[model samples]
Target: MLVKGQCTICGPELENGLPSTSRFRRLAQDNTLVDGPSLTGYYTSCPAMDREGTTVFWRDGQLLAVDADLASHELFAMDDGQNVMGRTLLLGDGRVVVSLDSEVLAFHSSLSPLAEGPWPCGDANLRGNPVMS
Candidate 1:
């Protein structure tokens, strides 16, 4: 059970790091967290159901990647070798490619984007190797 607490007042930090006034205590029962002290931190608008959303999807709910960027965060995209999300990327040749479970597209720095695609349902389909065949 999760209990939300009200921040009666955020205690001031000590000269070092400790709080000056300790007014709250961790509420637990059987070593389980029943309640916790109200915390003061920055928060962004997040979807309760977004914990399992795509890797680098846009705010509009379009999936551009099949993985998540829990590590590297780009301004508008996240890449996971086999999939990407956030914005439709581009190639110097100006061809718009697409990806699907049955089809996966990739680009080589030396090769043009339209050169080849749908190569084969190899890795991402077999052992879920998003990085290679």
Candidate 2:
């Protein structure tokens, strides 16, 4: 299914997961390594294998969403904030990528989610509105 933006470029889809690492590398080329307080707390000092975190994708410096590391490939976006800003491309491999104004970041996904629903604020807004005012 197409995302919520007008299409600027269209290409054939892929059957396998990621066709090439180059695709990821290219999308992440301009994205800088994320660093800051709000993010650092999500990661730990554990070894790679033991490390767990969520992979974040940013476009034009705005956070897209934290990808849920599950077989369902569920994506958890901030319900209170602006929706994903970049143009989304569904890869043939079934993964999604954003174009233009984008960056990608990762952190331990093992951290138990605080609560389910839209925004981190609470579940009250879940039934009322799409975005917080």
Q: Give the per-residue lDDT digits (tens) of candidate 1, residues 29-82.
A: 445322222222121111111112112212212222221222222223233233
Off by over 4 Å in 2: 1-74, 79-84, 99-133
Top-TM-score structure, candidate number: 2
Q: How accurate is candidate 2 locally (lDDT)?
A: 0.25
Tens-place lDDT per residue, model 2, 3-113, is: 111211111112333322211111122444222213211111111100122223332233333322211122433322333343332222324343332443333333332
lDDT of 1 at 26: 28
Q: Which number leads on lDDT?
A: 2
Q: Clashing pairs in model 1?
A: 55-67, 56-86, 64-84, 64-85, 65-84, 65-85
lDDT computed for candidate 1? 0.23
Which ranges of candidate 1 are over 4 A from the true structure? 1-60, 63-97, 100-124, 129-133
- The lDDT of each candidate is 0.23, 0.25
